[model samples]
Target: MYAQCPDCLTVFSMDAETLAQARGHVVCGHCETEFDALASLSSQLPPEPFQQLPEHKSSGRPPQVESAVYRPRQESALAADSGTTPAAESEDFSHLVFSPRFARPAHQNRMRRWPWVLACLVLLLLLCAQLAWAKRDALVVDPTAGTLLRQACNSLGCRLPLVQDVQHLRLLARDVQAHPSVPGALLISATVRNDADFDQPWPVVVVTLSDVDGKHVAMRRLRPSEYLGDGFALQRGLPSGTSTALVLEVEDPGNKAVAFEFSFE
Candidate 1:
């Protein structure tokens, strides 16, 4: 019987012994491609296998070409020899097409991309949260951003520093005079007012004592605790649109200290 290699379409003789030994799987002798020989087994050749030359033939019959495979496009050239019909000409010959059996899998499953994108977004959000927490003190200066941060902090059970707006705070009044009981000392006092609608922390008072020539004589930076004691107002923050008194006593810079200036931070 005859068998055709499904890969290279090489036609060759097959026996029961060889078919049983390989389980109908045979390697093509012409192209060395391995395929199931039983898939395209046939009793005879083409419709014709290949072109037949008459000059090399001594007999009326065609030469026996062992490695030749059928090609229907060349069948009409040998029609007088095989006498094949039009019905046989339309038969399926798809098995004779060559295809690589060892390439890629036909049904491979791929990993989706959205999971990776979601992970990246989560990491980015975490980074932004960290940055916001680190700069919360600076962010509280903005009215809108501070409101959002305060609301978030309330829900998250976290506390943020009070809003400090130097522009909203100013000295309502100031006084500098000799200390009552202390010798060679001067007493400094100022009334600072908060103009904003919201309550804020007490500002650091920067006192600059200048000489008669308007040159700086002495400087002092006093925190709320230094001038106001450890009172509830220091922690609860100063009320809005109100004024607070500040008193401090310092050693006088001799008689050249004739002028003094006050600033708040």
Candidate 2:
């Protein structure tokens, strides 16, 4: 019988004695790949012109023109052959348990993720900026938030609008008297104190005049510049934990105006 080397297609003559040596496990004398020699046993070689056989139709080995037992490994070398596969031959593997797909290097994988990381950081910053702007009126009065907002605005060359903390302002004293020199005029005076730890924008002082029956007769809103007069005091705002006196002059609302009440806004 003849057996073909599935790897190199070099055929070797085989007999029962030689085939049973390693239970049909034989190494090709030419290519040295081990295979089941009995699987490819044939009675005779193919006729004449050597043509490459389609690997899928036959075996995976490329076709060879002629087939013959390698003279040295079979005839002269058989007696010297040990007939057992050596331990080092394990490196010539024909089967694998699993195959791995292509993978990028560690740094390359990290590089590809950097853009997404940067985009997330930028989105977080935008969210914080939007929150600061939307709650500017509230945040600007917060000591911590105010400092952060001021630093950010200063860096961006932005002008922050002044905001009042009316709840923290106390109307310490008030007086509504007829103007001494101005006829039919009322001179309104009040002491406003800021109860907060921080300086706040000047509050609008609201004065309500009512009659004996407690019916509202007139009302007035006094701004800082109008009542304080001094540009320095108006610009500096109400100082923290301090009192400032303000005065307002307006035409009296006739006999109906008897009592007055004051509030800060």
Candidate 3:
């Protein structure tokens, strides 16, 4: 029978009697390494026991080259003398045959991709959240988005920008004169208008009183409560395209209060 070496891949022939004497273990002639000869035996050999026979040449039949499949056998005396067991011998020959049961299935390989798929999905969700955070200012004007932002701000204890286009408040008219009731006091009158088509929050009005030289003498910042008074609810916001009158009395800065400027911030 022909035996091939697993280490050096050398093929050689040995008598079945000699192989049996060695307990299916033999040293390779080419590489001088010991291996189980029965594990590497070729299938081309006859299946019957080797016996005395005359050598002859075959003219018609072609040789069949096939792989050998190993089956477990009883422990031989040579293996027992060497302190080897049948379990060890069976393990040594386990690589001789290929079985469908021992092979991994395709579905099991597909299951291994689940973790990567889950990771990609989580990454996509994080990307969407980042985009929403970047566009938060533009989205805050929507009614539903404003409500959601307010609710989240309430829970998180953060401030929410619920309105947009509130900076459209325009300056309309201004009149500065001396106070009628108080002595040596000046009265400032102004009319502010909101040109925007939407109701918006009020802004802080800044008044700077300048002398004849254009140098500021007195400056005061008026809030919505000071100008609109308790009559109009400040939280109710300012109406669009409407005008409001403001009257403020301030102490005379001693120098002539001239060239006063009014601004809303």
Candidate 4:
């Protein structure tokens, strides 16, 4: 049967009977290479063992004798018998598995996905923080308005006289001129509108006047008037060349205040 050695590309023939009993091992005569001979020739042989031995070896030597065993052909003898080039019998196939090789570790593939997951988590946290800030009704006012009002009220103790018929309003501070001893009063007006649909009366405005040092010099609530026109007013005595900032706070029933400040030069 024709056989090719894996270690050395040598093609040789063996007796049909010896090949059947050889199992997988075969020894090459040219290169003396031992290889699995049955691997490549399994498809060419019959499934059952051969029943007869060669007729020539039965008479001189018993077919089962060691001398009757098959022998590999020498390199020179194989070339002479085939009448072919000696180099053609041996072929090289070492580069077949190495041509295109690509390998990667399993951990490296898993690590590459972590950056994308972290980026998505950071983006999700920032979006949630922005939504939380927007849901709050916190009010922020400029510091300049608070600084100016306190200075005017500290110098003059004049208080504006309260007019009745104003129920939901409380007079936090009223500064009015009392002859030449007090400076001319600066009048500040503030109003709060109950935009809610519920029929509930609640304090919605807080007006405060402070000194230049941010101390609360005068504070008042512009109570809701019975007539429902002007809610509250603050009158602060002002000397010549004196400036004051009037801070008006409008708060809903929920006690969330939105503030506005005006400067009287």
Lowest-scoring 10 consecutive residues by lDDT in candidate 1? 49-58
Off by over 4 Å in 2: 1-102, 141-161, 223-225, 228-236, 254-256
With a 3 Å backbone cut-off (N, CA, C), the pairs that clash in candidate 1 are: none
Clash totals for all candidate models: 0, 0, 0, 16
User: Model 2: which ten-residue window has the lowest total lDDT?
Assistant: 93-102
Candidate 3 matches the true fold with a TM-score of 0.41
Q: Stretches of candidate 4 above 4 Å error?
A: 1-106, 138-265
Of the pair 1 and 3, which is ahead by lDDT? 1
RMSD of 1: 18.3
- Which candidate comes out best when scored by TM-score? 2
What C-alpha lDDT, on a 0 to 100 scale, does residue 175 get in candidate 4? 35
Candidate 1: tens digits of C-alpha lDDT, residues 119-194: 9999999999899878876777667887787788779997677777888897889999999999998899888888
Give the poorly placed runs of model 1, Cα more than 4 Å off: 1-125, 151-158, 163-165, 196-201, 231-242
Report each candidate's C-alpha RMSD, comma-separated, in the order given. 18.3, 16.8, 15.7, 23.0
Candidate rank order under TM-score: 2, 1, 3, 4
Candidate 4: residue 37 Cα off by (Å): 18
Instruction: Evaluate residue 232 in candidate 3 and report its C-alpha lDDT on the 0 to 100 scale.
Output: 50
Native-referenced Cα lDDT, model 4: 0.42
TM-score of 1: 0.47
lDDT of 1 at 122: 100
Per-residue alpha-carbon lDDT of model 3 for 1-265, expressed as tens digits? 5776777866676665667679988998888999887775653544456332222335578778688655455567666888875554345642343324324467876788799999999999999889978887666656687668767877999765424464677777888788999998888888878776445677778889888998888898888787776655577576667988778877878756768898776
